[model samples]
Target chain A: MSTLISLIVSGCATGAIYALVAIGFTLLWQTSQTINFAQGEFVMLPAFFMLAGMNMGMPFWLAILVGTAISVAILGAAFKRALVDPMLRHGALPLAIATMALSIMMKEGVKEFYGAEAQPFPSLIPAIDLHFLGATISTQSLGLLAVGVAAVLALQYLLNSTSVGRQMQATAQNPNVARILGIPVERMVMYSFIINAILVSVASVLVTPLYLAKFSSGETLGLAAFIAAIVGGFNQVRGAILGGILLGITDNLAATYISTQYRSAVPLALLIAVILFRPQGLLGTAEERTV
Target chain B: MSITRKVSRLAVLTLAAGFMAAPVLAQPIHLEDVAELSGGGATVGTNFKNGADLAIAEINAKGGILGHKIEITHADSQSNPGVARALVQKALDNNPYVLLGPGYSGSVKVTESLAAKAGIANIMGGEAAELTQTGNEYVFRTSFGQQSTMPKVARYIAEEIKAKTVAVVWVNNDFGKGGRDVINAEFAKRGIKVVADLSTEAGQVDFAADVLKVKNAAPDAVFVYLNEDESARALKELKRQGVTVPLIGETTLTGQKVIDLAGGAAEGALAHVGLTTDAPIPAVQEFRKNFAAKYNYVPDHNGIKGYLAIYVIKAVTEKMGKVDPANFAKTLHGMTIRAKDEPGILMDVTYDEHGDIDRQGFLVEVKDGKQVVKTILPKMVP
Candidate 1:
């Protein structure tokens, strides 16, 4: 049915966004054994910066590029140095609480500066509607899908082919061993944070037009993406992508068939089911701890 | 001369000086604005303050009420109910003649009781129907309540649009749920069947499923009880799903944010509004011009109500000559100022016994990228 197809298309779009967030979670957790709870804010704040750049008379593309670059290079590095690296030594709970505090600060900071008006981001792609397989797709949705898949492919290529990517992987697998092998483990962890920032920023740029760049945009987006990461397999890259897509589709299908009143509960239900049935997730490897 | 004679002379000189400097000694009439300045509701709170500020500035420029300068002090509520109560207490400590706003209905409901207990009149645009019905004599709403606005929407849908079956999708919140209850009750009275009633959580972004549900029901029209953000997203989803049926939303849909966020999809979407700025009324025209000049942006319904709240207070107090809290409340209740009589208000404002405004609700549709008046319903005074 057209309804089913429509739900699938929208589900895919939403899923792609969640996948980016899940990847951010997986990247940092793998490299540094830390979770950035402010991952959603990472997506949200950059869209505002991009808009700020555009408002300052920069062309749209240039602003987006510069905004994304700055977010990745400067803000990401500063966040790791100030919050993550400093508090990470205190333990996971402290770093998580710090990230939560960071999220609140980012939200309030943007709100104070930009005001609470839900400013719409201009569509990166044309608004032309393309219909295929009984579903209508906007060019913007297509852009999101393209970017999501391309980022995933590029990340996979880097992890497998490049020397630096292998070094980073080796550091994530066993930091002590990688350090003994002369690989810079700390630098890899920092690189992971930078990459995390870039992934979420890309998601923000692609999705901000559909949902305007506003203060509270991060709350639901971050929560849902965090849920997706947990449900998919927090440690596996492909699992995070699969988790995002599945959560998105499940949300839409449940909303369509069951009830909108209970749609919000579906993601949590999925999380619970995954936790009960398979503690390590569908694609996650169970870690063997040596005492 | 004796010491008593000198003291008497000093007392007489002081008394004479006090009498001579009476104009300078008189206290300025102060109104306190308790607003959500730094939180979720700050967008409207700040705009509402700006509107009130404009009115205050104009009033002062014309020598103020009863030759007394009007001063307004703003206390940020932070959009929390507890904070709103604390701000009202702080405002009361300063002994303001009137308490202005706390943006949303929840905060208004919370602080109105405190305002009443302190004998300070509260003027706000919080449209919750029960705000006045709680026997809080100090609370007066400048905006139309759901009881007044929703019934007219029902009548418009049934009588004018001739929609037999209506589908309802509302955000799951106080405002949206409150709107839903009223719309259902009003529709039941008019004998229109509500086919599907769906509600999504407050911050929900994806409406594809909700829209598809409406599409399946195939109602003659869809009525959305949602805020500006949710309304924009839902309307867009409705369009993409190719459901061409008429989409009517609550008054919040008339906001410019809906138009800006929804873009082309917002076209032809009808909404209930208190008054149209383009209604060929000089007062509205003047307000539009002055607001744009002052704030560098067009004023919405919230801003207009905020602007009018101050003027209503001024008009009432000016007639009474002195600012007495008890007298002010009584005077406002007894007053019946229509659009034709008042230069500030665009709609007829007659406060009922509960202090809810008895006014006509205007129906507007987005036409050619702007809100164009579709029709005006006759006033149904409650």
Candidate 2:
């Protein structure tokens, strides 16, 4: 049916954004064995920064690139000084708290600078619809899906083929062994942070055009990403994508067939059900603990 | 004896001078704005603050209330009900003469009772119908309640738009649910059958499925009572699905954010709002210009409602001098504040004991990303 096709297209568009943010979560968790609560804030910073550039009369593409670059640079530096250094010296708790504080600071800072208006991002796609297979979909939706898939594919390739990818996997699997083998564990960790920042920023750019760019958007997106991460298996890249798409589809279908008031609740309910049934998640591997 | 008498006379003169200066030593009239300044509803709160600030500045520029300069104290509610209560209490402790608001209806409802107990008059701008019916004497709203506008909105869609079958989609929250109930009731009264009555959660980002159901219903029109963000997303998604039925709803659709988020897709979407800046009233026009100049943005109903609330206070204060909390209850009942050249989105506001406004509603259509007036419904004074 036309309704089904449209729902699928919207689901994919929304899922793509979730997948992008979820990949950042998975990458950081895999490399550092710690979650970066500030991941969503990284996404928001670029979007807001892009807004600032646009407000200053810069072109959209220029603004996006500048915003992405600034976010990556700041996040990279902050992770090195605040997260990596502190965790290496003390423990992971401090790093977690540091990221949380950074998230709060970034959220408030953006609000102060941006004046809390839900400004619209410039649409890259034309306001026209394409009818394919009995379903109508906007150019924005198609563009988001394409961009999301490409980012994931590009990330997958980088992690699989490149020397840096091998080093990252080596560091994640056995940091002590990799460090002994001269894999530059610290550098790998820092690279992971940079990549995390870049991935989140890319997601921000893609999603901002669809949703109104507001200060609190990070919170909602962060929650969705976290959910997607859990659903996909925390450290698995492909799992995250699968989880995001599933969540998006389920959300849309539930809103249509069931009660619309319970639309947001569907994902949480499914997450609970999934965790209870499959403790390791859809793609998560079981880990053995040392005595 | 003569020297002692002269010293006594000088002491008497100094005492007289000190007594005269005491009246001039009065502190400025402080107004406290307790609203969500941070978190989810910060945008709405900021709009409220901007409007209140404009009015306060203008009033102070012309020499503040009763010749005392106006001072404003703001507390961020953070969109939490508990925090809202704490903020209102904090504002009261700061010794403000009047309380402006906690903007959200749920928050306002919580603070209304507290304000009543404290004998502090609240100049509310929230439009929840239940807020006025709580029988809180000190609570007053300048904007018409959702109940007041429901019948008019329904009638406009049914009669003017000539839409027979209509679908309803609203948020589960009090604001949306209440509006939905009123609209449904009005439709029932007019013997119109609602094809689909759907409810969605607040802050929902995806509405494809919800739109699909309405599309399946094949309604001539759809009514949505959703927040600006959700409404924008829903509108965009609906358009993406090719569901092009005439959409109508509450003032939430009038927000600039909705238009911005939906872009060109929002064109032709009709909404029932109270007034617009283009109203041919000099005072409203001046207010609009002044507000736009100060904030560098067009004032929406959120701002206009707050501005009008202050003007209402000014009107009542001018007529009744130094407002007595005890008499405040009676003074507000059936009170008529004429718009009088004020370009309010709603021309004139009249309130009864229940704090509901008896004002006309304006049906506006989003044309070229702006809210253009389609038709103005005559005042339905209750």
Best by DockQ: 2
TM-score of each: 0.92, 0.94
Cα deviation of B127, candidate 1, in Å? 2.1
Per-residue lDDT value at B125 in model 1: 65
Clashing pairs in 2: B275-B345, B284-B343
Report the C-alpha lDDT of model 2 over A1-291, residue by residue, as the tens digit.
777877787787788778888888888777766677777787878888888888898998999888888887887656676666767556567777777888898888988888777778776776578888877676777777777677768877888889998889889888999999989988888898888878877778777777668777788788888888888888777777888888888888887767676778899998998788875668877554100
Model 1 bad stretches (over 4 Å): A288-291, B1-22, B36-42, B71-95, B338-342, B346-348, B378-382
Q: Give RMSD to native, each candidate.
A: 3.6, 2.8
List candidate 2 stretches off by more than 4 Å: A88-90, A288-291, B1-23, B323-326, B340-347
Displacement of the residue A150 alpha carbon in candidate 2, Å: 2.2
Per-residue lDDT tens digits for candidate 2, residues B1-382, read 6999999999999999999976575467778888777776676677788888887787778876666677788788887778999888888777666788888887897888877777778887677888988778788886778878888888887787788788998888767777888899999888778999998876677777788888889998899888777888888877777778888877878666678678877888888887566455576678778888998988777788777766666666655676444565567678887766333323677777787777766778898888887776767763
User: Can you write out model 1's per-residue Cα lDDT over A118-150, one digit (the tens) per residue?
Assistant: 788987878777888878787777777678778
Cα misplacement distance, residue B362 of candidate 2 (Å): 2.0
* All candidates: TM-score of chain A: 0.95, 0.92
> What's model 2's overall lDDT?
0.78
Give the alpha carbon lDDT tens digit for every residue of B207-262 in model 1: 88888788889999999877667788988888887889888876777567678788
